[model samples]
Target: MSELERRYHRLLRAYPAEYRRARGAEIVGTYLDLAGPERRWPSPADAADLLRGGLRQRLRAAGAADLIPGVRLAAVLAFFTATALAAVWSVLELHPPRAEWGVPNAGPFVSLGIGVWAAWLLAAVAHAVAPGRWTRRAVALALLSTVAVVPVAALAGLPRPPLFVLLPQVGLGLVALGLPDRLPASVRAAPLIAIAATGLASVNVLPRNDLFLSYYSWTASQILPGAAVVLLLVVLLLGAGLALRADHRGGWALLVLLTPVGLLFLRPLGGAVDGNMRGAPNPGWPVLAATAVVVCLAGPALLPLTIALRKRRRGPGPVASGDRCPTCGRTAERAP
Candidate 1:
């Protein structure tokens, strides 16, 4: 085989082995013919198209044809939620109360998290207006910055949020990485709108004393932190509802996306209830963590059963004995 044919075959590896065995040569031939003489290396467009087709075929074989659309919806929602939450948290961190405690001013430029969130925001904007390649590059940069900030912040002795809190940002970013190359204008604009609205709310709510010390305190008394939790829950639920209206695939994606959010809050909720953040070791942490794990998994686990039940209901229900069709009020025809 020539070098061009070899490369084409390699790209075909994206498909399942069985599919490759059945159709790989045909696909490679089509591309090879298109390449003509003196052509080496698949064009970017062809590579991307092949990869996408392979992924769809794989999903279809897995009986998950809806997964692509579901994942795309989840990615958009997760990205918006992550960026907005980051903005609120960043602003909340900047509230004046931290200054009295010698916490460094965490402006957009000075703080690791601020920088990370800024990268995410830029990526969101790029997803909205930039080409697919540029959007992907921007998203990759944002994810890298998010992951890198943890070690850097720790090394620098910067005050960081709890591990659970930090994890959702990373989780959401990973989900967001699957966002479709194209999106509706409203979908593209959502993150910016969420950031603007949440940022302003966080700024206005102003953290009460001791708010930062226990960020998950949901008491309306705590204002900023409380609003943050409420805002996150609302966004998550609304997005889940919208996605679920479409299909079970969205339900699965929502479950996947909610796992990190559960982790983000459960530790703090445990601590707040047990007064652990006041310095005592909370014995309830393990129990709370386990419960959270169960809760997160339960939704996804039940989804298949629910889908099965719906299918059963739709199958061959008893028809009225009026000898008429249910639709168009037409008389039913009897088979000989």
Candidate 2:
């Protein structure tokens, strides 16, 4: 199969397990059958058809609701678009001294703008393309990898590369290689560790003031602490989730408590350079305010990283129902 055709088939695994189980091989075979020869590349039309099929698989995996398959997707896309627009508008309009037209400081707005869009776009593509365990883990790695690259790029004045080009290539490669081991475990393992590494590395390399650059700007000291808090919260939450499934009320309750502190401390450092629009109306306020406003918004986004991690760790008891143990037709379970 051609590269596009191969990716198209991989995305099929993102649909619901039953759906994939029923149609996966058929989907792969269909691609192979249509391609004329396994070694031959797909025609442009064949490639387009498979691309649409891949998107359908991704959409199916996101949720089973039928109200409008595209609605949630539209909403998700609109959200990021609004985020990007708000950031850019704030910077350009409030370029400098207005400080009143909603621009606080172009710096915070800009950084937030970049962070929101980067997170949103990669996330959307991940959702669009991911059809199963391996792809998702690989996508999680890609995001962490992006976080890793940001600092390296910033500190080294590294060349900027197009993410659209990079994500699929890298994500596929990771899945092709490490995924054999990465998929069966939790989703967060790679991501949490990777984020932690990114955050930790920033301590020595990232500018202290950049922490204050308005994704809740903090000092470098605050960065590591905050990053640790994030790591802590994730572990607790995952452990709690598993614990809850195992009927460990105490563990769940304790884990719930960690959230406030983490929320109070955690920050999302996008590519912007300023803290807040202290002097301008940047998207800094909205993104940071949003992060602070709703505890749930980041839940799903973070969950991917969490699941990646959880997949690595032990699961909840038979109560962790979705993941049925193949051995006994029982769900993956953990000790309380």
Q: Please, what are the lDDT tens digits per residue for candidate 1 over residues 187-263?
A: 77877788889788776675553445233344222332343375456556765675554434555455555555554
Off by over 4 Å in 2: 1-29, 38-63, 66-297, 301-336
lDDT (0-100) at residue 203 of candidate 2?
Answer: 46
Q: Write the per-residue lDDT of candidate 2 for residues 44-96, one digit (tens) a residue.
A: 77667656555444332442111122122222222222222222222222223
| TM-score for candidate 1, residues paired by index | 0.66
Residue-level error in angstroms, candidate 2, position 286: 17
- All models, RMSD in angstroms: 8.8, 16.7
